[model samples]
Target: MSRTTPAPWRREPGLVGRTVEAFLSPLQDAYLRDTPSAVARLAQLRRGAGKAPEEVPELYGLTGTEGLYAQGPFADEKTEQRATVAVHTAVTLYALHQQSQRSRRMHRTGYELGAAVRMLMPSGEIDEPLRRRFVRVGTATSEAIRADRLRELVLLLRRQEVPLDYAFLADQLAQVQVPQLAPRVRQQWGRGFHAWRPPKATDSDGGGSKGTDTSRDAG
Candidate 1:
């Protein structure tokens, strides 16, 4: 049999590998200096996850500012740095995708991805109280999205089913920003307050007399 010719060598791998190396090379140095904690956390996540490194979007959001502060030797350093990190993290995650199937799946889900990124945060950066608050808010927000509560709230507000008095609803809405209050409450408040109408005249059929004070004065 005639000898098989060897496949021609491709330079793409080397070119791509060099580009990645050049991009991340500076991060390795800067990371070593300014935010050792961040570097350590990333390493720990990589090790603990036991898979290709995937950059957590939440962590990126949190650390991106700090990363910009540490940029070196490039005019578009911040953008370049972030892009490099994103690419590297993506490649790392891709490599581990098959091995860490569960994590890959979880990372694809927004709630689970957010939770996982939160887990990687340094404890010192966020005190216990703030951490708890963030967790509660994040959980509620996630659940609301999953259940379509926001849409439901908007619909209720449109239909005027909310029960709060105008002034009270206004005060509550101002304080809590409840944009989803039922339309009933909104309409009652809007009409009563804007038109200067006294509270809707109570039914006079002995159900309740208008202008009858219900409160007992404290001695």
Candidate 2:
């Protein structure tokens, strides 16, 4: 029988964000670091994503502060899983949410954040407490963006080459009843987003890109 590997969150307080970063490292390599254009995008963001804003949420700590995700005494599997998912979801969501509140410079933040969050979802649906938080975060983000600012969001989405190319996200969005935006989003991302090999923990050397400036908006 195979043993289940322990989650990275089940470790020392200081190690949490680094663990998540490590978790994302392969994705980074495949999506951003592997290609010249993608690397250029990453360098642009890394150069310009800027320092943390005052009074931002701890979720975005991955880019700015680090070690802010540390939580102690996780009792069991469920708790650990929740913490992990919440970290990724919150970081991804809040990063864009904060950006949308700031300026049009972060307009693409919403598109990238939404893509990352959807990528992190389990199925087209996430359950319970986490789902509620996700919805709350989404609502807050929607409110921040408002109708006038949504065109920017759409424009940003149009620029992405998201690696997700399937009905899963469409189904997931429908599952969340999030206003039928998935088909349109899928349309924007288009066929190039679909990599020949499916996404996994370790990214592939194959050619494809799902770009984002997801980090660097930490609170």
Candidate 3:
């Protein structure tokens, strides 16, 4: 018999993940509280999605360099740029997710992108078109294309009122920028897709529960 190895998420988050949480949490909170700055930032970030940071000059001050280097600076400029792209993509996707739903928090902790897509299915079964979209996102040749594909999925998730973990997503997005690390990120997403199950109906009153936590804290 073989013992199962622990999933990556079982351990504490690394520097990049911590950085994402540090930066995104305050912005998320401010948005939830209806702060003017956060609202304007969200709009700007949304416009920056799937575009290069250089193209979005307005996104400069909002990147939160202090949070990115909270654990100390990156070893090189390339690494730093990749990390910035990840933070930008995750935050912008989150802005798109939160659009027009000011009363609801769309950035829920622990909800992976794949699992969030799974939640969109009515029967919790594989939906061909949706599955194809997920595949396209994973197979995207460029981070720009990947971000665009992710934006499409985010729209679907918004329709269903599903939430995602932007902090975890930022970490994954950062890893995906590295050739070797990209495979692991893809594997994590695959696991999330396979592991999700629909919410079980309540036996007590023969009705389903509302406002439930659907996230699986897995790799």
- For every model shown, the clashing-pair count is 6, 3, 0
**TM, every model:** 0.19, 0.21, 0.85
Model 1 segments more than 4 A misplaced: 1-19, 30-38, 44-55, 60-219
Judged by lDDT against the true structure, how good is candidate 3?
Answer: 0.73
Give the per-residue lDDT of model 1 (tens digit) for 6-62: 112211222223333333334333443545653554453332121211324433432
Candidate 2 lDDT tens digits, 74-114: 67665344333333332232233222221212211122223
Winner on lDDT (1 vs 2): 2
In terms of lDDT, the poorest run of 10 residues in model 3 is 1-10
Model 2 lDDT-worst window of ten: 1-10
After superposition, the stretches of candidate 2 with alpha carbons farther than 4 Å from their true spots are 1-15, 34-74, 90-219
Best by TM-score: 3
Question: Which lDDT tens digits does candidate 3 get at residues 1-219?
Answer: 001112335335556667767777788788878999988888877897666677788778776645787667789998998888888788778888888776566776667777677667655467999999999999999888998899899998887667777778888888898999999899888887776665454323233332235343221
Rank order by TM-score, top first? 3, 2, 1
